[model samples]
Target: MIASFPYLIVGLLFLFGLYAVVFERNLIKIAIGISVIEAATNMFLIVLGYRTGGRIPVFTLAGESKVLVLPTPQALTLTAIVIGMATTALMLSLIMVLYRHYGTLDVREIRRLRG
Candidate 1:
């Protein structure tokens, strides 16, 4: 039960983000929710690669031995982190542009004012 705590937390984070994305009226809050979801996903990937008492996936001089944790998830998490960062930056920039044009960060206001 204790071992699954991280997974549970990640799930909660995802749900919270989803809720914010669905119900929030503020554009900034929606962007933040997207970031939260991305974080939860990255954490899930890292957790998936975790192994108890497992060694690094590296070849040793002696010989191949012992359990090695799968590196794929870690690699994927890293890549996702990079992509998420870029995506978040782009989202925020677009939000800024929207605010400048609409003079507000409320989704409804932006939609109503859209040309």
Candidate 2:
């Protein structure tokens, strides 16, 4: 039970972010919500990579007796963070363009342009 608590929290946070993304009316809020979800998932992955009472993955840090922290998730998290940043940058750019064209940030209001 104790072992899974961290994962549970991460999942819940992800779900909450997902709910906010789908339920929000503002485009900015939706973007933020997605970012939140991504962050939570990243954190979950990183935590999963970590072992019980593990030390840093660095070889110089420990004389090989201590268990090393899993590097895969840390690498993955770095990649994920980069991807998230790029996505946010793109989304914000699009939002700016959208604002320039429509003068509003509301997703519902932008639908009139669809027709």
Candidate 3:
């Protein structure tokens, strides 16, 4: 029962993020929503590593052993970080160019290349 709670929370986060992305009018909000969803997915991955009787992940030079919480999620989170950074930078750069030309940040106002 305890383990199921995290999954439920993660699911709710995913739903909220979905709603934010689909309903938000501002581009920035959409980006933030995507980020939230990504983070929730990452959390779910991390939670998958927990065990009922698992020990700590710390290791000593003397050969003391422990259960690793899960390195895959941590690695994936790093990847997500890089992706999120790149996406945000690209989005902001695009927004800046739009603002410079249109004198506004509203996505609806920038209609130069629309066929």
Candidate 4:
């Protein structure tokens, strides 16, 4: 049960974010939801790469044990973080522009303005 704690947390985070994105009316709340979803994804990646009693994959500090945490997932997570930040920034900027044009951040209002 304890071993699945991280997975459980990830699931909950994802669900909450999804709910916020789907139901929230404020643009900022939707942006936050997207960020939360990204965070959950990053957490899931880290959890997948975790290894008990694992050491860094360094050659100079050679140890008797050969178990090392997988680096691919970590690398992917880092890349995802960078990309997520850029995407979030762009999203927020677009929201700002829309707010300026429509004078509102509500999606329904924006849709109504479009017509």
Top candidate on lDDT is 4
* CA RMSD of all predictions: 1.6, 1.6, 3.1, 1.3
Q: Each candidate's lDDT (Cα)?
A: 0.91, 0.90, 0.74, 0.94
Model 2 TM-score? Answer: 0.89
Error of 4 at 62 (Å): 4.1
Model 3 spans > 4 angstroms off: 56-67, 111-115
Candidates 1 and 2 compared: the better one by TM-score is 1
Model 1 bad stretches (over 4 Å):
59-65
1-115 per-residue lDDT for model 1 (tens digits): 9899999999999999999999999988999999999999999998999888777777554246677788999999999999999999999999999888889999888888876
Q: How displaced is residue 38 in candidate 1, in Å?
A: 0.5
Candidate 3 structure, TM-score to reference: 0.74
RMSD of 2: 1.6
lDDT digits (tens) for residues 16-115 of candidate 4: 9999999999999999999999999999999999998887665547576567888888999999999999999999999999999999999999988897
Q: What clash pairs does model 4 have?
A: none
Q: For model 2, name the residue pairs that clash.
A: none
Q: What would the TM-scores of all predictions be?
A: 0.92, 0.89, 0.74, 0.93
Which of the two candidates, 1 or 3, achieves a greater lDDT against the reference?
A: 1
Per-prediction backbone clash count = 0, 0, 0, 0
Report the lDDT tens digits of candidate 3 across residue range 1-115.
8769999999999999999889876777777788789878877877776666555455443244544555566678778778878877887788677667778755565654444
What is the Å distance of residue 106 in model 2 from its true position? Answer: 1.6
Tell me how far the alpha carbon of residue 22 in candidate 2 is from the true structure, in angstroms, after superposition.
0.9
